[model samples]
Target: MTRYRPPQPQSSPYISKPGYKALNEELKGLWKTRREVTAALSAAAAEGDRSENAEYIYRKKQLREIDRRIRYLQKRLDVLIIVDKPPTNQQQVFFGAWVELEDEEGNSVAYRIVGPDEFNVEKNWISMDSPVARALMKKSLDDEVSVQRPAGPIHYIITGIHYTED
Candidate 1:
């Protein structure tokens, strides 16, 4: 099978105020953890031969992961534009809007439109660049949106829209 893959498109550079704060906090915490890991790695290296040292190998892997995430967050935070206030027109769906949708089966689902870097499935926060969010953008109450999925197209009606910190 062919394993070639194309580069993905760049995500939107807009983030909510809370999302920005969270990213900044994470970057700071990662730096602290990296320092601790460096110390542990050095200690492990000093113990003896490095080839058989499990602690040293594990610490090295941990440090690499930390450094990767740190670099990503640093670059992302530099370009992110924080959207702290609600739009002048709150009737439509926009970035950081809490949206409620009713599906064909009459089941209701709630989601928040957020930046790609801060999307949390557990909290139903979707990335603004996601298919559903793109369909919902600029849509008003009672507006219908259809998102194309791998299986088929799913339709939804905009039941509610709100702008809240949560």
Candidate 2:
């Protein structure tokens, strides 16, 4: 049998205050759900045959999902470096800053640069390692930036940048 070892955590580049709080809350919620599911699974098993028990199967699935999330949160928490304060200069882009971009078509998009663990496009959050964030970093408003994407290069003009606790 091969012996398995958990990998050492790597240093996290950055994380926003709100994102960190969310992760912490999520971990707590997962643990609570884990306990609830385990109890429910035991109850389902006591009811009778395990093979045909729907409650048992459902609880088992829920437990697996909770365990997966718990493991992820544990690993991520170890690596993350939280940054509560934004950069002093407001004119340039920096971690945890909300940035506005204008594409060639003149359409504008706003995104907030955040840690990888907090990256959510639908929520307007982006990772620091992302191509768009990479291009925007250290750039001031009105600066033209080009990023290399899998499809090709994409260009953007920085329209605005802001940082706030909320």
Candidate 3:
């Protein structure tokens, strides 16, 4: 049997100013970490019997992971378009907007629309390419949004929209 996987969708090239800075910092740190790991790997290799050397194996794996992230960051950084300015029309929902939504149950939720690279669930930051964000885009306060989720169509009403981090 063949294991066939569909091609993944492309991530949006937009990134917030802070997200770009964070990626740059991470890339720099990874380079420094790679140097230290390389030194450790060399030290472990010098101890002889690489097949039995746990430290050498561990360092090699660590270095590989670090390199993989560094490469991804480098490429992604090169193509990312930093979105630092707020939209001219602040009344409407757009990128980098902190949107407050209300459900039919009177439950309120706040979500910040952010770039795919910077979206964090803990921070309530949703990727702009996400279904919820896409549905919310260009919507004004009191606008109703219906997102088609796997379970069902989830509904939300835009209660507030702000451009700032708060």
Candidate 4:
């Protein structure tokens, strides 16, 4: 029997213009790849015994993964709100704001506050729902913010906030 799992809370639906475009392109690419996978699956099925065919089994699994991603992307794209312009009040940190912060040790780091779907850690983009971003929201430059971490509370001073024209 399968375990019962509750549905997750809805994530923020906001996405940057470029992020939205990238998702749309990914959906389009998925469709094309799905078609190719289906064709390969059919070809493998034709050459094999249903019970013992590795090629057929592999192709079927590949197709299932592709279809799952396509379904998710289609649903996600329908609800995303694209934020193409910077907020009117640029001084305060908000979604899409590139914020620079200095830690207690005077080490500086920059991060862009973005929606969950668009957050990229490697690029230093943090989800708005994250503890650090939540504490930073609506906070202006020179403000001190504290975030709760597993290790303990960490403090930062907001040194700058910038918004880009997307």
Q: Which ten residues in a row have the lowest lDDT in candidate 4?
A: 157-166
Comparing 1 and 3 by lDDT, which wins?
Answer: 1
Global Cα lDDT for candidate 2 = 0.87
TM-scores of the models, in the given order? 0.94, 0.83, 0.95, 0.95
Candidate 2, superposed: residue stretches over 4 Å from native: 1-13
Give candidate 1's whole-model lDDT.
Answer: 0.97
Better of 2 and 4 by lDDT: 4
Q: Which residue pairs in candidate 1 have backbone atoms (N, alpha carbon, C) closer than 3 angstroms, thus clashing?
A: none
Put down candidate 1 lDDT per residue, 56-113, tens digits, no spaces. Answer: 9999999999999999999999999999999999999999999999999999999999
Name every residue pair that clashes in candidate 4: none
Q: Model 4, which residues run further than 4 Å from truth?
A: none
Residue-level lDDT of model 4, residues 77-134, one tens digit each, is: 9999999888999999999999999999999999999989888989999999888999
Displacement of the residue 109 alpha carbon in candidate 3, Å: 0.5
**Model 1, 98: alpha-carbon shift in Å?**
1.1
Candidate 2: RMSD to truth: 3.8
What ranking of all candidate models by TM-score puts the best one first? Answer: 3, 4, 1, 2
